[model samples]
Target chain A: MSEPPARRRLGPALLAVGWLVLLLPPFYLSAFWLQTGLFAMAAVIAAIGLNLLVGTAGQLSLGHAFFLAVGAYGYTWLAGSPAADEGLSGLRLPPAVAFVAAVLLTGVAGALFSPVSGRLRAMYLGVATLALVFVGQHILLNATSVTGGFNGRSVPPLTVFGFVFGDTDDGLTVFDVPFGGLERLWYLGLLLVAVASLLARNLLRGRPGRALGALRDSETAAAVMGVHPARYRAAAFTVSSMYAGAAGALLALVFQRIVPDYFSLGLSMSFLAMVVIGGLGSVGGAAAGAVFVTVLPQLLGHFADRIPLVVAPGSTGTGLDASDAADFLYGAALVLTLVFAPDGLAGLLRRLRLPRPRLRAATPQTSAVGEPAVGDTLKEQTL
Target chain B: MSAGIDVPELRVHDVTVRFAGLTALDGVSFTVAPGSIHALVGPNGAGKSTTFNVLSGVYRVASGSVRFGDAELTALAPHRIAALGIARTFQNIVLTRGTVADNLMLGRHTLTRAGFLTSALRLPHVRGEQRAHRERVREIADFTGLGARFDTPVSLLSYGERKRVELARALCMEPKLLLLDEPVAGLNTAERAAMARTVASVRDALGLSVLIVEHDMGLVMRMSDEVTVLDFGRRISGGTPQQVQRDPAVIAAYLGGATDAPVGEETR
Candidate 1:
């Protein structure tokens, strides 16, 4: 059977545009801007997973940071302390093994804790997962022997095939392109982002995806249809956690450090806000939401100082405080998004594209296909 | 997955149900042959729905047993009953929010357990099963007079169309016995007539035995081969419609004192 042109052309067309976006940046942007862009790109990767769990699955998680912390700590422990028991200090291990281990362990840990989430509904699950933030931070801070405690451990540079990455000891060249520091790291970050996005896409399109949607629509209906809702729900959580872990491993490599403070509740809240502002159950919404969220702080921090607010700046009020400003704006955006656009920003975009004038006239006729009204649904079967 | 037994298509023996202090179904005993359309009719609050809930495995029977083919219904879950070739429709439409095709596709979920990993990976098996599921549902839609609107979302559908989709979805399950509760409860005369035809055709086409709980007196009289009447949770009469219509207890329950002013009518 022949496939539609739209389906055939769609992926490659999008990929071409994505390649342009990633490869053309060096020609137009400065180093500092590139640095900020990389940070935002990394954040986008993490937010996509959060969007799936919260938006598509209708699960409420307040412990996304736990996965990131685990990923970072796990990578640093396994990679940087490969032979800790031996006399050699700062023992080195292959970065590939560490990355894989981090993602797997995080998935396992999430599966372990996800059972608690399965038993409870939204509010209780949110509260329970919230404890993960405190617990994760405590473990990272107190496990001095492995995590390196308060001062935080320095993450060794990742080396792929003898090509060292992130602020290299000495600059190196490969095929006329620099394979050191920021340049090498940028390629790695983009690669992770591409891979994660592909995985998330496949996930939301298949059986697990359908199961998640079924569970959300009606638990009783799902149960009646032979779907074990609890098991799939737990699986969604674990899969989402694995994505978070992968993103976190990349983040650790980018920073070349692992710290307890980076994975905080505030960071978790940002991911939540992104999913809320993005349409639930939508992949495009996740990307759009991440872009808005990732770029807003820059515009605000750089320009919001000039744009007057209620509080006077240069006073004790501290209106320009970056962290407080980001929090306030994110909180306000979430409430506004909920009230004005319950379906989220992506839904708002879809609404704009729709033919408002024809919506009503088209409904009945368009839906005339197979809808069995309430009465028909209850039609007495006679033989 | 066939079990060796001579269990009736459905056997509800001495099933008694209570609500607060009132009984909903008092020792209701009935047997449905393998291929028969049994009609249960009564006035409002007749405990017909309670019987449906018990039969479909939604509500646990307070007392007595429900056997479907070779499987015991009481211990089985609603979905399990459905899986065992006994599917039912609700009084209120329970179609999920999606395209008409999607709703029916969900019905085939039990039959199409394509592994999660295979589906996620978009394997050939996944595509094949999905195509088969859609084709079966499309056929059901055509039978239900919904051949045109397969892609339209249910939210955009009217009450009648949505109900059609719900029934089509259930029909796609290929049930041996279909339990339909008040299928013609709310509809215009023409729509009801069309539904009656649709129901009769679907049953005949699939060779399915059905249990119909209905409130429409004319429909119940015309459509059912046998009628069972319940009043205040107790079976008052069971026979052909002519026999049930002529029974004194049935008449007394509807009209008081044989053609005087009706029961509960104000003298003023």
Candidate 2:
């Protein structure tokens, strides 16, 4: 069936408007907002990857933070110059190469776990992956020469083709606004998010996505339709790990320091929260969810003094801490989303967009003459 | 709608399967000639579904072998069996959540070459391949009389329409052998007649072998060229509908040996 011309054009028009809106943030927003946006962008990339595995492929993972740590540490170790005095070892590779390599390294880590990931299903796989986070924490804490142990290591400024993402004496300015590390990296984050979203959207709308969707619905049906369950599961996990790696690398650049404690089980849970709260399999929904989860805590912390019943960090009072408040809000959101809109925000948005009840009546009558009216009645019954 | 690949004879030789301590199928053997309709008929728990599972590699056989052309199907994985041009529909409708076109495109999985990377990148070749497949899928949907519902989401379709979607999806594979499990089990009389017509036309037009597991004897007798009857996991009778209709053992197994009349005569 042909869609209305206006409706067909609406998607691209809205997309263009969104891109324009995102482009203005670096120029107009303060450093705090820019940092939060960058973190959200990173989350968006990771959440999309996780959604592919958990939502689309129907594989559950609880060790996404392990892969992210792999990416973060992988980049730091590869790009940091060796410091003999501190007993730190590094490859001192170019920042660009290190960035790409870090992602690949996480993919390799995921591939290494494929024997277990490919065999296990749903909750079993989640428990298996939970071990990765603990194992990763142990390595990060003990690997003194590579990871810098308890104190953590400072992240090297990302330099690409003689241009640095960090502050430079060159004093680069555009439209009378000084562009520092955050501003420069904002564009980079945007580019990466765009590419990641496009790639995910393409994948989900194509042959591989359908195969994975089929697998999620029924393994027997998927297999009979020529989709290898284990192979696809492994592939999805590897891809997801690479996405987490990229996010981790970007996060390192944003945070300006790499710490083992930050890449804990809590981080993985937040990522899971992002995808689930957004919508299981929708790319846009995951991005929105990531922004909501990442930005809410930071915003609460920023405005905690003004907002009643919420206190700033390190403050002891009768009120809840900002982080706790953020947690409570999203936990309630998760519950509400599950109860009212089980398909998540994406499905909710779709229902709002379409006049579904009316459309059933509006459907064209195409049955041949003398045919029984069984289809019409059945449709009504199902509805 | 004829596939370019040659249809292959499906030879099940003394196939036996057991789950735990229970034997689900014991030494059941049947051969489906190329370009013919073969029906596997039995009462509930008579191992019809078990045999279908075995043939499709969902379940491993305890003994005996199933061969499609020269390939030994018993040792291969399910996807590998599908790759060898065996496509099937579940007894219960198992259509994925999407438009009819999406489900039909899934049938082309064995035929299409686009992988995760190319699909993610939306490479030129992937688009071309999808367009080509979409055209053929639409044609198959028309063949199944689901042309009007091509773009309709499967959730919106009636039960009979969903069954047709499954059939169209199987046809999209362009398989040499099609396995249908209870194709018209839940359809109304009119819908059942329409489904029978579609099955007959698909076999006639595509010239592919079909092994059907059906509870409806009227549809089975009217459409199938040969019938294999199972009783308590054993092959009790095998022949044309008329031959099996008169077999005392077939009648006894169907009616619990209470009468000598042919099975399903009253229902037919």
Candidate 3:
């Protein structure tokens, strides 16, 4: 008998809808709104990479933004200078080649540098990566030859053939309405996010995916099962770095200049907050987190600045309280959501959509509450 | 005839393990014959686990060497020892973070050449390799009576079932030597018998050299072909299971010493 249609088609259907949601929205969004959307999409690209290293491999890396910085600076230098950027040297190559080179160089840097983290795990690795950001900022500040030093570098505007993609991308006449940089970028952002989602989906679903999970579970068990935990962990770190690198390049494209302050420790924390809010190791959660964080602040700031009323008799006031209130709200949202739903937004949604698992039946046999599944039982063996 | 099976072997030469001035293993020496189930039995603190840890590369040997078919195992990492076709199961089961199928597939990790980028991209080669591993894992699970629950996360399985899953994962490595530590500990009579049967079947089917460390006298006697008994960090006697059972030192060690090691908190 033929397999049920639902069984055969469910995966493809989900994949299709996922891409369509990401790609088709630029036509409907205004320029300002599209800018926000594009920014969020870039954040998702970076977050997925961090998720692979921190969430899946259990290798904590706090300096993920350093790789993005590397990519941004590398791309900008190559695009801006004749020597560094082979494409921008008056003999402009295709934008696609420059893009590919940016990504590959970032990946090679990640792979080469990841050996530092090969022997480290958890907090120490995080601290080491944290050191990278502080050290990286110096390279950004003093390396006048490459990154234009602290003044940073202006990347040559991205151009596809002679189409001119950045501020110079000839305006689009859509339904007689014109759109430009932000609008075009909205679609680009969507495409990149879609690509990141697909890559993460495939990686986490199969053999290598399982090996990553196994490495997180137990080094000894992973070894006995013929897995090299250190090797796979290093590989995950490198790929994750590449993702951050790509995202940085996107940022450089968006701003037309790559700056040291943009890829700072604060940015790294922002990325972590996004992943935590979304749910670690979850694709949809990461995107949702990026959207909420990127969008909420602007909406709150605009609304606060526009409101013109104060409830005081003797005091003059800006609606500073309103923005503060929004900040409070976001913080409260993080605390309440995390305290009650530790798995983040995706897990909360999962629990709401499905029945609570029949875990009580199986839990006492092993101490697995800390990890989602299997790991608890496996941990029992390791202990 | 050589009496033992003809395959690559592991030689443990005068290895000792020291911890903070205490000697866990003192000049321990032995050889595991290929395809032969050699039993390492001892008192609770007699350093059997310590020796297993050393061989598995979890604990670095203080002195001497371990040669696996001529490759020196000392100073090499744990995963390297594993890749050399020496796989083991812990006295405690470490199942990993997924379903039974996922756990077993982890065993094929060294065998599989696909990388994170390949898997992430869903490249054709990685996809084909994933499919092949799934089938191999299914066969291993079937051998260990875990065929029916391949989709179920291992956390849901019972203790006996989890142990079986651990064995299934180790088997997936397709090891030359299988080191099992107290494989049937805490099992009920029926469960213990089932576990013994699984052990025997895995050895025969996979053609692996088996070295089991067990304190269960009856199970050890039933499962082992040759026994090396240890007491107080030293070898007391060596013989067939019956002979070891009758050895005075082995009898005293089992009859009087602190054979009770509360399993303790597991490693994650």
Candidate 4:
């Protein structure tokens, strides 16, 4: 028998809607909103990666920002002019190469740290990962040549072949809209996020992904099943770090300059918050959570004067400023989401959908609660 | 089809396991023949589980060696041991978070060749391998009576169903020697019988040896080709079920019914 019509149509329907949403921002969103969308896209990519590592593999890492810094700075140094700083020497490679290299560099860095990552358990791994942040911060601050030290450095705009993401001498316009930096980047960011999401989803659904989930649940069990826990953990960490690298490179491009402060512990925590609030193990949910977390502060800051009981940054009579308000809002949201729905927003969405047939009777609610099915009796070889 | 390697008997020679001041297994030795069901029965703390652990490469031998085929298992890592055709289940269910199908596919880890990058790229080869493995997983799940619950999360299965899933998962490894720890520990009489039948059928169907660490003496007596009894970290007896059952030392250590009663009458 064929699948029900509704079930068959669901895939195309979801794809159609996803495409529409992805295409709408460049046409309708203002530059300010487009910039916000770009940041959200970057976060979406990173959060999906983090979910794979922290949620799927059950390895907690607190030094994601270290990899972000590596990506941002790696891109800047690789593509920018060597003479821009005292001892800094840029390879002056293509921005696209620089971007890809930056991501791979982060993977290499993660691989380097696998000695600790592969050996440590969840809580201890997290603690060990924290060391990456401190050590990264020290290098970024002291290595004035490569990182531009405390002041940071200017990022070279990404140029793919001949078409620059940045504005050209004869600035291009499409239809009635100006295709400036944000508009051009809107498309680029959209493509990257789409690819990233697809890849992450694909990874999670496949054999390796299942292996990772098994490893997370029980190392001994996973090992017996021929899953090398340490190897998988290291691979997950490296992949996740590479995703952070891509996000960092994108962020550097959007900001037009890079700073060590931008890739701080706070940034790492915000990424964690995104995954947690969106739903830990769901890739699509991570994107939604990323958008929510990234846009809230930007939106509040934009409408700071109008928002009730909220002031702009640097205001003296702050009940709560825009940034602080965003923090409080998301903090409360995180706590409420966890308490109300441990699975996060994705779980809530699942519940909102219409219940399907008894195709899957193995949900935790119905599982293992009562007597074995009568049909199962025949299969048993009771002594 | 997997390449043919000479399936050799597993020999444990004077293997000792010590944890700080306590010795979990003291000079325990036994051999499991090719394609035969070997039962390891002992009271709690008699080192039955420890023997399984040592054989499966989870515990290091304080002395002596374990030979599987020609390779020494005692020196290899757990996963390496698994790759060398030994797979085991836990005394406690150690299923990962996923549907019954997902957990079953995890058992195919050692068999699959695609790595992370190939998988991430969704290469044609990876896709093909995945389809082939999924087909096998489905068939195995069906064989183990879990075909209907392929997509069901393991956590939702009843304890008995979960135990079957665990067995199905181990079978997915396509091991030369299967290690089942407490396969029927929490099962009822009928379920225990069913489990015993399943294990025997699996051994026959897969053409592999079975090493079962079970508390249920009745199931062991019925299912095992050979039985070994352990008591207080020492081998008390070894022979066929009838021989081990009638051994005086086995009776003294277990059926003698000391204060720390052996897993005896209740199981029988």
Candidate 1 lDDT over residue span A1-383, tens digit each? 12356756875898689767896554456565566676666677778888777876677889999988888877787788633553223335687777788899888888998668676666677888999999998988887777788767877767777767666667576555544466777777778777777767776765567656666766665656556667777887888888788878877877776678889998788888787788776777776677677777765665654766523323465455654576678778889998877678877766665567434323322112334333333233232
DockQ metric for all predictions: 0.28, 0.48, 0.41, 0.47
Among these predicted structures, which one has the highest lDDT? 2
Interface RMSD of each: 6.5, 7.7, 7.6, 4.8
Question: Clashes in each model (backbone N, CA, C under 3 Å)?
Answer: 17, 0, 9, 8
- Which regions of candidate 1 fall more than 4 Å away from where they truly are? A1-19, A26-32, A82-93, A157-165, A169-182, A303-318, A358-383, B1-8, B18-23, B254-268
Sort by DockQ, top down from the best: 2, 4, 3, 1
DockQ, Cα level, model 2: 0.48
B188-256: candidate 4 lDDT, tens digit per residue: 777777777788878777778889998878778888899988898999899998887767778777756
Better of 2 and 4 by DockQ: 2
Q: What lDDT is reached at residue B35 by model 2? A: 93
Worst 10 residues of 3 chain A by lDDT: A374-383
| Per-residue lDDT of B168 in model 3 | 76
lDDT of each model, Cα atoms only? 0.72, 0.88, 0.73, 0.83
Instruction: Please give the TM-score that candidate 3 achieves against the real structure.
Output: 0.87
TM-score of each: 0.85, 0.95, 0.87, 0.93
Record all residue pairs in model 3 with backbone atoms less than 3 Å apart, i.e. clashing: A78-A85, A225-B107, A378-B94, A378-B95, A381-B92, A381-B93, A382-B267, A383-B266, A383-B267
Model 3 DockQ class:
acceptable
- What is candidate 4's lDDT per residue for A145-256, written digit by digit as tens? 8888888888888998878897666568787777888888888998899889888888887877988887777777778787788998988998999999999899889988
- As a whole number from 0 to 100, the lDDT of residue B175 in candidate 4 is 88
